[model samples]
Target: MSTAQLQYQSQSVAKPYFIAAIGLFVGQVLFGLIMGLQYVWGDFLFPEIPFNVARMVHTNLLIVWLLFGFMGAAYYLVPEEAERELHSPKLALALFWIFLTAGVLTIIGYLAVPYATLAKITGNDILPTMGREFLEQPTITKIGIVIVALGFLYNIGLTVLSGRKTVINVVLLTGLVGLAVMFLFSFYNPENLVLDKYFWWWVVHLWVEGVWELILGAILAFVLIKTTGVDREVIDKWLYVIIAAALITGIIGTGHHYYWIGTPSYWQWLGGIFSALEPIPFFMMTIFAFNMVFKRRKQHPNKATVLWAMGTGVMAFLGAGVWGFMHTLAPVNYYTHGTQITAAHGHMAFYGAYAMIVLTIISYAMPKLRGIGTAMNDRAQIVEMWSFWLMTVAMVFITLFLTAAGVLQVWLQRYQPNPMPFMAAQDQVAIFYWFRELSGVVFTLGLLLYILSFFIKGKQPAAQPTAA
Candidate 1:
């Protein structure tokens, strides 16, 4: 084993966070399935679970689980990178329970009562932060979130500062701090819808496209360093270049959202050009991952993690980069705005860039958490690999079907000489909707199998290569 593989046990503080993350991930997929079914059946859950409510659960869970994953990643890696114990393990655990409790109560509020009722009970009337797309959480819940984020930052910040500072820890801390800062924008709700949306993108677009990429890059670099036995110098250098590109392109790319929100006419060109450049970093990431793998000094035992890391690069490029470019042009977006095409890009981008990276870190770390060596047995790994392909392929089909549905709807309802009404146009795309729903089912099955992989026990074998 390499010296780097002797990672300190202080990372154990991350275990509960990862467990909670996987549990919430299951909830996210289930709610997503509900939303997919609602698209086709419309009355699948009806009054008990309306499309809007289900959609809220689906999106919010994604956000929460990803946050959980990031927290876990930070807890797991920061201590090792800094060469010390966490500043306060008890504080990390306390924050975990607090965050999990708050998240559960908030989701229950979404599900158990009417949204209006939730707003009133949660004291949204004190401040109006509800009813917006992603900012639909009540003001009180938003406050809880802010408090949790601050506690998290304090815990991580002290740990990073107390020991040897590495490029990975510094980048992760910066990303996490930016996340908390930007989220403050969510508390700012203006009466003017235009201004509301402008700042809203500061939190929404900037988080995913900006600081979140920094978190993603840092985590990936840490994993690559541990897994590939690559020189930290090389990985550290690449991390700087990628994050620099991400911020340079992503901050200005917020203009794309401003274009339709009545910001200004000139934003169209600005949005088009800068948003077009947003994909460059993702493409660079793909090249970076494979290059590191081929130059590996030692083959890691955790093959699943390697697959996930490589997949992140490829899928992120296809979903976030290529698909995003498809409609980022001012002309194309003018037609496809708010269509299923946007949803298609979203599903792929989130899963590819964020979800896959979380799984990558979890896959690498969980075996150690379980007292196993560096990975699960070969049989479990094979099952995990199968689940990976199933989920990835299913997502691809879902995106294609939705993209087709969006195109058909645009033609029938917008581009036709005599356009059909919205509802009427929907009927024409029903087939695609059904296809998308079926693809979602496949994704769920894969998720279930992924869960089952943890329980399937086998002989402890050294890591073996699945490819030449």
Candidate 2:
């Protein structure tokens, strides 16, 4: 097939964004390793970088890179899905640099000065959205985010609205719009601690469990249709069904975070019931992915991308669904609320769902972006696959070790009659922290290999049949 005939010119806008995403992803992993070590060493960076600063950078980078991935995915897909070019490729490019510059500056501010100094320098006292967990971005930075999101939405919205409005494109647009809208709530941080916590979940939980799932679904559907040569009609209908299932369970599942807060007592049952069902959509996603691949009409040469897509389905279910359900119950959460179990679920869930999906899209899209044929060559792909297993396995061990630590900590500190003090409990769980840190090191190695695979030169593999 001719490259021009098969590719959209507007898709080129995504290349830079993906490149930035990968670069930030590496930084995120490195910071992650640093934080993991801080868990065991306590004084690894101490007053210089501090565990909290490293953690904030690690998490904030994760969110920023994922946003970059989402934007890239939209830029790449909207044109094709709409059967027309982007409304403003130049605008897209402009926003790309704007967002990237803003991100780098914010990160520099984060590292170069104390957070308080950074906040004062950024004028956080003007609106005071700082010091609130995930809303740590200065108010000015938050406004920048909103402006960027608006520009993004406008660009994507016009393209989708102007051309074909396929199920996938419409869903993606809606999700992006919803994401921006929910983020606005972060600016409304009242002084009441209960009220503060109450609305915090709106930005956090709603994005991850709600609109983000829609984004994930649409991207997965697009990839499946392209790679599997599945009927668009069939796949489109399934997209609606999957998204519907996601919203039905996930919206109510937001109640899960309300239990311990100063909210109504009935939230326990509501959260338990709804969050338990939240896994249904993820499970359906797994089945939908495999079934589509099994019934594929074409043998796509990019086996690595196929692996990524399928892995997103399976790992998202296991990490976000199964592990989430393990403690989402109000009773279980009451004990494991702030424990390492939450950390375990969080690490796995974010990696399995969001990180993996972004990587899946990039894996499928990058070769074409680079004009390197349908995918990376067999040798590079083999190395990429190796990184995938190494990272995935390392994450599994990290989660397990954290869970073990959490269980022991809960038993010794929370559940025991003569409960140990918090610091003593931490000391008791030090071994598990050591294990988690080691696993993080392995995860970093895997990440390094992943970066290296892109540079490997090798012959492209012939198309292989989809597995039975």
Candidate 3:
């Protein structure tokens, strides 16, 4: 390689974002494991950590880790995509540490005693804030999320504003903008109103389903086209298809949550119709990725990148948009709204669509950052690609099983007027809990192995003749 052309040998000059990402991923998996266990043995792991605490932990860590990973990817990607080094790596570094500290501190506060601690501080546990334990979670963590959002948006905003924007760059910018806008809504404290659910859904629903999904699909397609030697035109078309579909379907799909809330029966129709089609883009994205790669002019033989993109597309379909729409109808959701079926969609969509996309970007960047050529790391890539598939597929199976179980649970509880008949309607839904716990273990194994391969070194490039 020429002196002028050697890609820099790090995620960037300062790597705090990467460190933050590492911390978030660690937290995500560990808490996720604990959450899985709580299902199998209900009394097995509370007080040390209550189920609501675990539930909040599980949910927040997912959002936090993806933010961390995206931050790191931004540091790597903005510079490369813009063809300019990051405008302020120092600011980026500070943002990482700030978020890292805040994320940890917030989780600690969540675990420590939400009401009593706040009650002691305020001199009464009866205060509105002290009521639901989950409320305590966002109190501190919300600050952390806001700070992280500012740091990221400022960095990306300045970068894109200064540089020549490509289609990929613009797509990412739109996602970050949506992320920033959504973060503000997270601070809303809807103490007296039932409308808070709809409010909360704006941030959660719009960010993931609408904007972030766009970012995810765009980045994945970008990596695949560059790596797979496919025609750029074909890949860009896939990107457009997914983005348009996710947007058209996602914004209104917030109605799914509005059904039982004080909203209206009309939303049932709105949410059901759009959400049913939300999965279309994801389904197309999956078919689009594999079809592109399958028709590649020459196979690169790197299974990881190949699998990463493919798994992302497939899981998004099965998990996020598909499973969600299954019970999305007002009639059906009236029974299944709060049950385990909801969880099935959560695990798949986030893991498949968002999680896989972030990893795909990392897989692409790791090789570039290490100064290795694609021709060599292709083998290690295969290991990674398959790992993505196996883990996500395992999650899909787990989710499907639970969804079926949740269906049964809802049947016994909703249809039978004697509501207390079952143990929380059939032994407190014990069997489904156990199934979720076991499935979580399988997921943990997949993540552990996926993390392990980064340490196994890939082959170095063979020396080339010096340019004449």
- Pick by lDDT: which candidate is best? 2
Please identify which of the two predictions, 2 or 3, would achieve the higher lDDT against the true structure.
2
Worst 10 residues of 2 by lDDT: 1-10
How do all models score by TM-score?
A: 0.97, 0.97, 0.88
True-structure RMSD, every candidate: 2.4, 1.7, 4.1
Separate clash counts for every candidate: 0, 0, 9
Query: How would the candidate models be sorted by lDDT, starting from the highest?
Result: 2, 1, 3
TM match of model 1 to true structure: 0.97
lDDT of each: 0.90, 0.91, 0.70
Instruction: Give a tens-digit lDDT track for model 3, residues 1-468.
Output: 222222432236324554455557667777877866666566756578877777777677777778777777767766666776677777777777788788787677667766457446544333333233233444445555676788778887888778767677778788878878875666564664675666777777788887888678767867776656777777777778778888888889777778887887899899888887888888888888888877766655444666677777887787876787788888888888877778777777788888887777676665555445443354555556556766776787778777877777887787667655545664656776676667767777777666666666666544232211
Query: What TM-score number comes out for model 3?
Result: 0.88
Which stretches in model 3 have alpha-carbon errors above 4 Å? Answer: 1-19, 115-140, 370-386, 416-422, 426-429, 461-468
What is model 3's C-alpha RMSD? 4.1
Clashing pairs in 2: none
Error of 2 at 448 (Å): 1.2
Give the Å error, residue 451, model 1: 0.9
Per residue, candidate 2 scores C-alpha lDDT tens digits across 1-468 of 234523688888998999999999999999988988888788998889998889889999999999999999999999999999899999999999999999999889889999989988888777878888877888898999999999999999999999999999999999999999999999987989899899999999999999999999999999999899999999998889988989999998999999988999899999899999999889988999999999899888888888889989998998899989999998888888999989999999999999999999999888888878788998999999999999999999999999999999999989989999999999999999889989998999999899899999998776666543
